[model samples]
Target: MSGIVVFGAGGRAGRAVTREARRRGHQVTAVVRDPRRHAGIEADGVRLLGGDITDPRAVALASEGQHAAVHAVSPFTGPERGFAGLDPEFFVKAAEALLRGLTETRTHRLLAVGLFANLKTPDGTPVLDDPALLPPPIRPFALAHQAGLDRLREADTPVDWLVLTPPARLERDAPRTGRYRVGGDTVPDPATARLSYADLAVAVLDETETPRHHRTRVSVYT
Candidate 1:
């Protein structure tokens, strides 16, 4: 069984992923802002601990001694910043903290939950290339995801890292058949619509154990 550190256990995707990972027979450490608030989750086999994604020390503490980490922290939460408001400082700093923690612990694999904006059209154009196309609060985060992908690409660490892109749809209540498709870099068929959060978790765990896609980006859809 793989040992995992989930960076944002209280968030939607993070919660889904952590539970799914547990269901798949992996050991999980559920890192949250307040462990006491998540007593139910904590009791259900996750080792819950308080953590702040913006703080490297907290991130490192949470990231330590795990086989790999899933960066499922909701990257943005604002109305004005649009997609542009995804704080680069917060994400980049958190990444640095994670890297440090993993390096110190000598952990090897890292699978990141990248935004769909990191994907490119068949013509090599970005989906979020225009300001008008972006949601007022989500644009910044999409850009931050793009920037995070670039930094991850350039990181020459000893660990193996993979950046996986999830569909733009954030429908938490969607059904999941545990079946989906995965691709690299190029965008998937946008015409098909949203993917369930459960399917996304399946894809994440599949990549976590397989190691077939390393240090590159994989886009997932259903």
Candidate 2:
């Protein structure tokens, strides 16, 4: 079985990816800030590792011997938590660390979960730019995410990375239909754009195994 290391395994996206990876018989290293608090994620083929996504040493430790790594780390969990202590360059640090660590470990593939705010509208305007689509208060988080994506795009590394951007309406409790549509950088129609966390995981693992896209970002929705 292929080994996959997942950062942010304690979060919704990370948990979904971990479940999908195990369901497909892939060995998973679930990296969280503290393994003790995330005891529930432990399973037959999953190994829980405590590590920081922005630390190259920790990332390298978790990435060693893994075939591919998933970058699902997020700084802000919810609006209720506020953005007071949020680092604007959180993603940039993560990209730098992941690239350096993965290169050192020879882990070639990196699959990342992206924010929908970065996707452009039909008129070529980013969703994050439009206050109607994205609230002004949340823009900082979106900008941080964009910075991380930019870092990945500008990097000259051997690691092949792909960022899967999900729609705004990502339902965590929705079932896995094993169905999703891939689109380019533009955002899909709001009326028709939706995706389940489970299905997103399916797409992540599919790319992990087959790797149809490389060194770029794509929108995934149902």
RMSD of each: 2.4, 0.9
Query: Clashes in model 2: which pairs?
Result: none
lDDT winner: 2
lDDT of 2 by residue, 1-222 (tens): 899999999999999999999999999999999999999888565899999999999999999999999998998887788887889999999999999999999999999999999999878889998998888989999999999999999999999999999988999999999999999897678435899999999999999999999999999999
Residue by residue across 1-222, what tens digits does model 1's lDDT show?
878988888887888889889998999988888888888887678888898766767766876778888888765543443444345666676667667777777778887787776677667767687444355456567766676777777877876888777767756898778988887776665434467888888888887888888788888887
| TM-score of every candidate relative to the true structure | 0.89, 0.98
Cα displacement (angstroms), candidate 2, residue 182, comes to 0.5
Runs of candidate 2 with Cα error greater than 4 angstroms are none
Instruction: Evaluate residue 158 in candidate 1 and report its C-alpha lDDT on the 0 to 100 scale.
Output: 74
**lDDT, candidate 1, at 197:** 80
Residue 207, candidate 1: alpha-carbon lDDT: 78
* Candidate 2 displacement at residue 211 in angstroms: 0.4
Task: List clash counts for every candidate, in order.
Answer: 13, 0
Candidate 1, superposed: residue stretches over 4 Å from native:
75-86, 130-133
Best by TM-score: 2
